[model samples]
Target: MTLALAGGALAQDAQKGGTLRIVGTADLDHFDPTSGALVTTNNFLRATQRTLISYHASTDEEERIRPVGDLATEVPQPTNGGLTYTFHLREGAMWNTPGGARQITSTDFERGVKRMCNPALGSAMLTYFVSLIDGMDTFCDGFAEVEPTVEAMKAYIEENDISGITQPDDLTVDITLSETAGDFIYMVSLPTSAPAPIEVLDYMPDGPEYRENFIASGPYTPVDYVPDASLTLARNPAWSAEADPLRAANVDNIEITFGIQPDAAIQQLQAGDADMVYDITIPPAILSLLTATADDKVMTMSAGRTAFLFINTVSDNNGGALKDLRVRQALNYAIDKTALVQQMGGPAMAQPQSGIFGAGVLGYHDFDLYPSEGDAGDPEKARALLAEAGYPDGITLKMPYRNQNNQPEIAQTIQAAMAEAGITLELTPVTASDYYSKFMTNPRNTEEGAWDIAPVGWAPDWVGGAARSVFQPQFTFDGRHQTYNYTDYNNPEANEVAKQAINATTPEEAARLWAQVDELVMADAPVVPYYSEQVVLYRGPAVENFQPYALGGQGDWTNVWLNR
Candidate 1:
């Protein structure tokens, strides 16, 4: 089915005054917008926070994904040779407070941008904006020198105003970028860029106090929150539908129950106990049953997430085998992607991916620099390369994989394929909570050769013109290491191409350059691009206006309402 039609299904007459129930396995990582990076957290934030710009919840894929003004009067056009953006804040956009709603101002927006650089918050998205915004990197550097206290944070923010952001009046905010970025407007639409009141600075960022003292500027406000237990959101009494154009505010309350597994969530959905399965995809075991019995309720689409295996070249494990380019390339050739797709629950769940860019992002092209035999892989070629790399007999490698989300089965499938090419893999399982934050992202683990191969995944930070979003954080390391860039791989030529792509005047020109960079990075084989996935979600029968959001690749909560 076309995405437009599927999105249109949700727009039947909207009903109001029902509690929407949501269930998920894991709790949110952070309630503060600046600190959270997970998409699930972003989904919750959508109801409580308002960015300067945001996409309209629509049925048309392009219109639904494109950025438009939320707090701002409209999406601003870049001036000063694409180096400057001027935003006029919309009047009457207010923050929900204890006494009454307070007007949201340009200072609030500036405060939000400054909070991202706070060392205590440790925002994963800071890297995307640090280099582009004028004097932002310097501000961040100065912030790192201070103690992580509320007093110190307040002093830092008060002493140093971002030179680029200037507010001449209460409503006007002018921003100048260090570099020309065509995608700067899109970056502002992210949750990290959501405005917060200066009063929030009284509490420590990301500390317990901050979460407790959370304020809302959107349609809903968090009334009660217990981590790993439950979260209850009610309509912000101060919020007016006339002021905000994006959210319908159809449901009166949103109740999210934590610690429910995907299978259990599915059961709850089928039994009409739950309205939606939060962020978890439908489990593979019951996919066919739901497809036949409840096809209209199912929604599937490709998000920007790409899953791959990171080959640690810096590690000296297995006689520093991965350090050789031929060995790395052989590892890429060794895996049968076709089999890997089936292990991930058929093409509906995942398709073989050859390059870094996924399907949804611009500049994404289909090409495999390293050719495989009908996506089954060339074991013979892999064996030949292994012999050439001085590992004719066999090479024993240690691999780590996440225990959740059918990853263990995918790891086994890769292990079997690698065995055919004389590569023995020892698999280590890590829990979902610690996999990315503690294990894979820990540079100490890579330096100590804890594991040679680790399965990892990434989704574009934003939707369109996201070539820089995909390549910069994962592939290139300037000086400071990105959390997800575990290998610490840097290529000057590839980096230069990526820069050109970012600076390209037209989208077509940028896409060509990005595709070129993808080919260059793939030749290095720092990672094995296994598969890109299309998530499958199921909504309760009573749920209506369940438009599939392109960013989260799931039903948009802001657009959904209860039919009953």
Candidate 2:
């Protein structure tokens, strides 16, 4: 397969009509990018929507280390020592409507950014992505106590009292940062930068309607959507050939289904019922089948998302299980990640993720001690530690799991390991929707149904420590931090250390500090590391110009085509 950037050259005789059916295990709790805060949902938005500047899927290794550009013609560059960024908007870019009419323009970009940054809009992305843009932080702060209301946010924007953003002209906007940000390009690739004509999200604060009905500036526009079930896309007729040369406007429709299990999705793919499946947890059965059929038709790809066990430290229940660092460490040591991955699939096909940022990311180190000598599946050692803590049996711990491809089997593997280590794990697998809402979003409390451990994953929003913000305290409501720092394993010193790493002056310094943060996390054992997923983008044998990588979906499918 050719490694080409998004919108690169493709076959001239590519089929102009066909349907691509994509099936996956789950759907976003909500379609709104700011509110859903789930990576799975965001993946759809990435392909179906467009960001101002996206990291190029086919840049050099160094350029790929950070985002280059996806929508914007060029990557934003700073004029001063990273204080000011001059972004040149791509000309002729316009929004696409489902009805196949004309497109919209730069104002859409402007309003989108404002909506995302608006605190009253109640977008969690504001806490994550808004911090990157100039004055956005201040604009957000201006609304902090002003009630999270749409009218208030719109009024704030109309008055132009936002601190960091300056739209001096219609096409030219200047962003002044609070401090020097060398990896500004990385910040641009986040969903917050993905423009959403402010008008669409104006009154609607929370719901899937906005995403299902809203117009987009992407290659495809949402033509149909069924709640928690399916979404269909049609070529954006407004897509200009000058701006997006490889736009197929072909493949008559792209249909995406949600809530279908990965194993089911794989079966559908084998039966030719589906064209692609996202959110696939590598299952051993599927891997064997793909390997057996290597000659005929099969391809698998690994994306940059990492799955792990989120141990809620702040939970008032669980009887201080997470409070004991020794217990956390024991849990970390007892589980055989290699066995888990193998049970799920092959090691060659899937890598065990070590840190928050997987292989595709820079400054990532295999900091987690799993896969190391003495740490991998040391059941005796784990038991010894548990006994040392107090040979207390009958500790029925609840473990939550979402129905991914191999999750049930994976959970069994973990349960078996923990049981052998003298810890009783009660497998409580919940529906995908309830699993996300109850276990994931619930505040940490004794009353809130707590889980001893649950699967959690993240896709980097930006390239730097900002990507690590999920682990930060602010992201969690007053109660739970189930994402990363969920274990209530708070260390003021470590917090300061990570802050120093994020705010570090140089890349080298920042890397050193990030290493320190990793060391702290591993030492604390807040999470048990799991496999890094291989991005699997299934296409018919006739399809061409599609590359799969960690950065984004289908690794720039802009030039993809089907043989008629």
Candidate 3:
């Protein structure tokens, strides 16, 4: 009933394919993995094109997942409180160029993780993400008082008496944390886990060259990378066919052009000029066109991402109207998620999200687990809450938003809902670039309070219960937590619980603790809890075996085929 794959089937099946051209809206400021602050962009570069410990694709109900032999031969074994991992280097793994010059080794991983943790690198990644390891927090925090020089960082590592990490051999690494954390393996499974060559790194001049020459031991190797413009990757010929399809790339070469001048990239796809559009949020007009006119060319999938309206707690009005828990609760009840999703083709075309982590993620908690505090279309209750908060009938608030067309539409829907309960809204829309450069760059400025409320969104980096990391006291970008705590939300108890969740040893235990934190956040209502984002994708007809998941984008491109 089934045909077995022929020997050298992968290579035999390979047709020395045409270059797959992927166009998108944004380009990496730097190609270094640690430099990424957003999830979708980071995962696109890390998951399909690069190799690491684990990979995930889109989800229907279950998390469609795949992971190749990255730097590990098997599931990591834990000693004390961290990991002791051994990677049996697949001899075939090499850089994209010939002569197998980029062959992977144990030493590469040592250098990579060390570089990731090094304070001198000034990577935001090392701070919050890697702190699950015992000594990493101290190393990341060491940069605070004194200049974190290379010698100082190296000496700090050399002198640490922690049981968290050890490089026992060139290919083996061991870690012991402060406590036995449940997601220990998942922590190491991050993009940070992928190793970099110390040799090439030795030549970096503490500048952009560090990003340009960023190497890969995964499926593709960087050839040329232009910041805010384009990135090109060629296949690693030495990459074995037997490697995990989850982490491999099938195409011979890949070209990703960025900052594609809004709507230009979509035009290319409509003209059949691109293999795919990786991360650009397609506009509704283009989405409708794809469905009605180019149905054959569009492939849609659900992504594990969430989008919501965040209220700044530090606002001059103490988060303005949103400061009132009842008002915040009323806003959550006012929006029609079903209708909003229908217009954007959200839940149907992309993964429908309600909870923070989205469905199928390992540690996700059901919204029902906590008492529902917001308006569920109860006009009477909404009016009662608003009245209790002493809001007058003529209250108006200006909510600033990034100019995603759907966002304004969603805001209007909320406006209409609130209108029914006697409230008016002045929906303020601005360009995405301006929105980020202004309000998001610094939320604490005196003038920043001009905007009373706005929609905020987040996409997680991994599948672990650490999804709660976003709620950690406040969200942090780079080393400065104050800027992103736009809500200026401060709860010592919630912050403490977030730390506990990070170090919790089991999902049951972590969930129990995080549940408390989630309840606290939902109750605070700094931002009205809204729907999660769904990633909608369009695949070309020739592309086959395109399984989608949250963490991995472009699916498992390694086994995909272009029908010749």
Which candidate achieves the best TM-score against the true structure? 1
Clashing pairs in model 1, backbone N/Cα/C closer than 3 A: 10-545
RMSD (CA, angstroms), candidate 2: 4.0
In order, what lDDT does every prediction score? 0.83, 0.60, 0.55
Candidate 3, 109-144: lDDT as tens digits = 555555565544434345444555666566545534
For lDDT, the strongest prediction is: 1
Residue-wise C-alpha lDDT for candidate 2, range 417-500, written one tens digit per residue: 777777788887777766755566555522354677777666555543443543453222323222334444565656667667
Each prediction's total of clashing residue pairs, residues at least 3 apart in sequence or on different chains, is: 1, 14, 14
Worst 10 residues of 1 by lDDT: 1-10
Off by over 4 Å in 1: 1-12
Question: Which ranking of candidates, highest TM-score first?
Answer: 1, 2, 3
Candidate with the larger TM-score of 1 and 3: 1
Question: Model 3, residue 172: what's the lDDT?
Answer: 60
